[model samples]
Target: MRRVVQYSTGNVGQHSLRAIIGRPDLELVGVHAADPAKVGRDAAELCGLTEPTGIVATDDVDALIALAPDCVVYTALGETRPMEALSEMSALLAAGINVVGTSMVWLVTPRQADDWLRVPLEQACAAGNSSLYVNGIDPGFSGDTAVHAALSLVTRAASITVQEIFDYGNYDDYEYTGTAMGFGNTADAERPLTFRPGVIATIFGGLVRNLAAHLDVELDDIRERYEPWYSDQHIECRMTTIEPGQLAAVKFSVEGVRGGDTVITVEHVNRLTSKAAPDWEFPPDGQSGVHKVVVEGEPRIEMSTSLSHPALDVTEAGCLSTAARAVNAIDWVCRSPAGLVALEDIPPTELIRGVMW
Candidate 1:
């Protein structure tokens, strides 16, 4: 069994802990937690497991690294702290610890990342002779491999569009709901991160660029579109409520265009409730959350994914999928060459489903 350490206890990180423990080939060595309440707690309890594991959570980064575990599942948040994540990953790599995590989703297609950040990470990998792989639901299975499989049946390629449509009301994170996404704010307020100029390019544009590269197409320009929908009436959720005329829904799209035609695109239609945006695109079953990919080509293929766990709700299950994506890739990353590993670099068979069935 490969010795492993989990780097955080967030929603995804906790799920990753459970995954690592259940894996037949992995041994849980230690866990890291930044929250004062979580530190010193048993890893199993922190992850909501019924029993305790000997492993306890700690805030000491150096001490955890000193354990010399085979890999670190660094599922800590990175969207708001890209440089900090890069620095941490670089140091871990330089220490010869292989890393596979969901923090930097764009690293699934590393070529699309900024050169400045990429250079130091590459150098660190070389120095320590350790590898790093990053992935999540959107930039991982739901976007890249799914789209790649759908496009294989087509003889002619026209366009590709990948979308994530979900309700964000149950997501109780104050920073993400109020500040980053403007979920409970008024319609006139400044748009959220998805709508902000260049933000999409910085975060998810990697999907578009990577798809274009896979298709061997040169994009003329990468364009973005944002539309925020307001609720006419009050909407209630488990955590917070959306008052009348508040920002209830948002639609964001990034397209890879070539000579006026869209070849690759990534889109999201997110709302606080299903009632908030009745007319927005949804799965045939009208599910509130789904990741969809459409190939507007010869076969005109379309595929959608909806994830659920027995103990978790739809949104929480989505978080688990993100964690599973990273956890499942841990062994492969640890065995790979020391450098940035892209989605294409790994064999598709390596991503087989686990005990989740």
Candidate 2:
């Protein structure tokens, strides 16, 4: 059985943790949490699992690696501190421990950092004779899902768009604040940078850019716009002063030109709360759900599924399943080539059958 270790104890971490523990072919070796609150809780109990292993989650990486886990599942948010996270990833790979992570939205895509980041990771994997893969529901499966959805239609496609809407009633974090996010934009002439390192534009920016490249569409310009609201709004999750109107919305768009010709267009809307103008509820539009994909074509097709699991939103179980696919494919990637890899590079049935098989 493959032994797995996990890092972080947040949304993605929770879902992933449950999945790892429940797997019959995999063993939950350890859990690592940056938060001191959960530093010493049973691995299972910490993640709401009924089966409690004596293993207490810890923040000691050196100790966790000493256990010789086959892989490390990392779901920590590396947006603000990418360099630090990469350092940790480097150490794991160099120690001959495989890694499956979703901290970066575009690591495996061609949009990944080409300088110090990619070079060191490739070298570490080679030195340790191990493999590493980065993926998640948004840029990972959503991009692939949208592309596949578009292929179902015939004729030259004009453009494509993907969007995600979340009910932010329960999201009382600092990340969504208008001042922090720069939500609303007054003019289309100005595409202001929020300076947020991994904003939605920064996160899915590569997806649209890479898609245009793959289609041989010369990219001219990429742009992003934000919309924020505030007022009395009723949210399903909670009652707050900052209601749906007082929320942030992000609109991402990409225009591709072939030989200076307009080839395709991509756009998406991400509303954190309701935009209750004259009449509306909480999160005026977007509600908590799995991402969505829409492709415009001759035989138009669409694929939509809430990526979150039942009874759990971004729990340890989901994180475990996503990370496992990345880990299970490690051996396959090791014996193969180097550089970036995509989910399309791996078979779907094989990925799903990891623990089951």
- For all predicted structures, in order, the TM-scores are 0.96, 0.79
Task: Give one digit per residue, the lDDT tens place, for model 2 in 170-215.
Answer: 4433453333444433333233344333354555566766777677
Candidate 2 lDDT at 130 equals: 69
Off by over 4 Å in 2: 108-111, 152-155, 171-201, 230-248, 254-268, 272-290, 307-310, 313-340, 355-357
Residue-level lDDT of model 1, residues 1-357, one tens digit each, is 789999998978989999898788889999999899999999999888878889999998899889999999999988788888888899889999999998876687888888877889899999999998888887688778888888888888788889898887777665654467677778677676656899877777888888888778989999888787888998998646788888888788888889998778898887886787888886558665889888887979988888867777788888899888888888788889889988899898786634453
Clashes of 1: 0
How much is the lDDT of residue 103 in candidate 1?
83
Best by TM-score: 1
- As a TM-score, model 1 comes out at 0.96
Q: Show where candidate 1 strays beyond 4 Å.
A: 353-357
